[model samples]
Target: MSDGVRLNKRVAEDVPCSRSEAEAYILGGWVSVDGVVVEEPGARVGHDRRIALLPGATAMPIAPVTIVVHKPAGVEVSAALIDPAQQEGKQRFLKHHLHKLELVAPLEKSASGLVVFTQDYRVLRKFREDAPEQEIIVEVAGTISEGGLQQLNQGMKVSWQNETRLRFATKIATPGLIDRLCRDVGLRVLAQKRIRIGRLPMSSLPPARWRYLTPVERF
Candidate 1:
């Protein structure tokens, strides 16, 4: 290619490995281009450049891990990753389990619901490639006018940045919109919980506990 090919693709073509394995080697800091180590799989290199693997750079298979946690209110989603005491369930955390455990789709501190963490790049890539549709249940006190309900259903416009410009990226399921709707209708929101993401539901998952995704499960 004129602009150079992705490092991973070039590595896979040159080496006896799959693209994913090449990526793993790159991420593990085992790949060098023209004597310089390049960690990014998507790094560009000239077609005629030198590519080398360091000693002990044999393909080592890595198992992907995906964990689902039932988050409780008042706990910061990001903080809970390091603090196992904040997590639910009887399973204890091991030091080895902490490696590359990345939190996904973190919820607000005041919200309680399912949270996801994974060491799998494929799972993370799926989320990044497409915005997963979420379903949330909001509890509010007081009454909502019929007009307000209609407006909410039809997607009302809200202004931000000192009301100088309106946000074009408007949606009905966003938490901000829910809060605005409740405030406009003279209601007080008590709770908000995301119950579903994509086709996965937080069914039967107890609060403050965590579980691993089954082999057959996706997302």
Candidate 2:
């Protein structure tokens, strides 16, 4: 017999469920080895060790939830953890299930709209790994010359923070591009907000309010 195996694999082999379900049970504090609770799925279990599923252990897999918050300007995404009141939702479900939340693609303090928080690792991984483009609407009060407009559309290299960087006029806007537009393009930006991430739009999510992402919603 092997000296040790991953906890999830051992649970999957002994229990009538997949490895993912086993992991969920473990994370939910349902699995114990020699009377000690082991929460990590990757925890090693000796072959000779006694592994037991607690009486209240759930056999079903828990689906991860993703929350879409219409974050108002000046509110930090990280503030949600310190003050759940910052999350603008009257739903009781939001109160009970807000623990272990992870923020994704946080907006700057000066900007507003569509901040995402999730318990799903897959969603977090997708955003981090993909570095998907975003859509932003910037309200500026300045005239652009015909030549400047053409140059914006064609993309330009601007000096930013003592370094040169490429700025594009496509729907996607990054902090660097926004800074270059105000400093180099000679535009006075009055407001800027992100409206879309990937194909997901802020849509009708009221300012400072939030809602759970529906099953049909992806990223």
Candidate 3:
């Protein structure tokens, strides 16, 4: 029943931050209109109204939490695992653990690797395809061609043979075929960690521990 645009939308249009960042600010209680904190990003406000971040709020808008979970096979990313009915129309998945943080993203159940959980959606936004800083590193263990890795590293133009696979530093990878690559390379895939989202390397932190993203960590 509201007539104004959403706070995230307004922030995206006016500030350098993405819509996700604006939402994060609202969720973290950093967003204020004329000085009053507003919890709802959908709240209506004038297009010309002034919005500000609480002093020092940007130091770390999200609480200190980041989990590196080794998702077991066969679990769906929905909100419900056993019975979808219990979730009231929400699908069940591993993301359920971070429900308290209000983060939303579908995880691939069949894949077992690194799963990151955080209240910080802005950090997540960096993984979007359009984000300039985004880069994905998935280990491929297969009998790749002599130049296969090199081809991927060069990012050859997508063709029928390549299909959706994109070239990484020295390998071709798609979002869904890591398992096959592992089989081909004879690697058992003991584990696959999502090592990087944008320039943030997973190696920087210990597994299963959550930490507040430093200002330098913000892409």
Candidate 4:
């Protein structure tokens, strides 16, 4: 430790800003060492490495993050959501983001797609008090008749994309509700995936990879 100074201390002295501000600069991806961006404020440097902020960089407050992970079939939601390798997004990774995350709208191990884990209390409260009002869009593969489709859409809605895909929209169904509903209608389900929950869609996120749910994004 005596051989080098903490990067935050170096940056703080150079920028003439507070120690906390320097930490913010590093966490915000504004600080670099030898022309390479380094996010760790506690990184040790021996006075040899060139360190500077990017052009017009600002040390803005780092907000709590929400992650939207595309869970793969047969993978447990808890395991998949927290894995470091599964994270894929532009958001800066902070160690704290992995703690105190409230997992929402859990899917079964047999099912897959669009699982959310968040540290934001507002997002948690929304799911807590208004979950029943949220419309869930599930894409499934099965067979059903015109009459059965009519029956399936009696209180909700359903769309037929092809012989291999049928989309169902519902208001907060249980983990196995779709399977049970399809079974009741004589439809044999081959596969099922929840593509959307409330207004958030899975979009192009590949399986097992996750992206940040930005400040503007809501469940």
Task: Estimate the TM-score of every prediction.
Answer: 0.55, 0.57, 0.36, 0.67
Candidate 3: regions farther than 4 A off = 1-114, 118-121, 132-142, 154-175, 180-190
By lDDT rank, best first, the candidates go 4, 1, 2, 3
lDDT of 3: 0.47
Please, what are the lDDT tens digits per residue for candidate 4 over residues 36-109?
88887888987887889999778778777788888888887793366667677766576657768778778877
- Tens-digit lDDT track for model 3 on 106-143? 33564433344455556455444343222333443335
Best by TM-score: 4
Clashing pairs in 1: 88-208, 88-209, 89-209
lDDT (tens digit, per residue) of candidate 1 on 105-163: 76777878877788888878877787566666666677656675555555434322221
lDDT of each: 0.69, 0.67, 0.47, 0.77
* lDDT against true structure, model 4: 0.77
Rank the models by TM-score, top first: 4, 2, 1, 3
In model 2, which runs have C-alpha deviations exceeding 4 angstroms?
A: 1-61, 79-96, 154-176
Model 1 ranges off by over 4 Å: 1-60, 79-94, 155-177
Candidate No. with top lDDT: 4
RMSD (Cα, Å) for all candidates, in order, is 12.3, 9.6, 13.2, 4.7
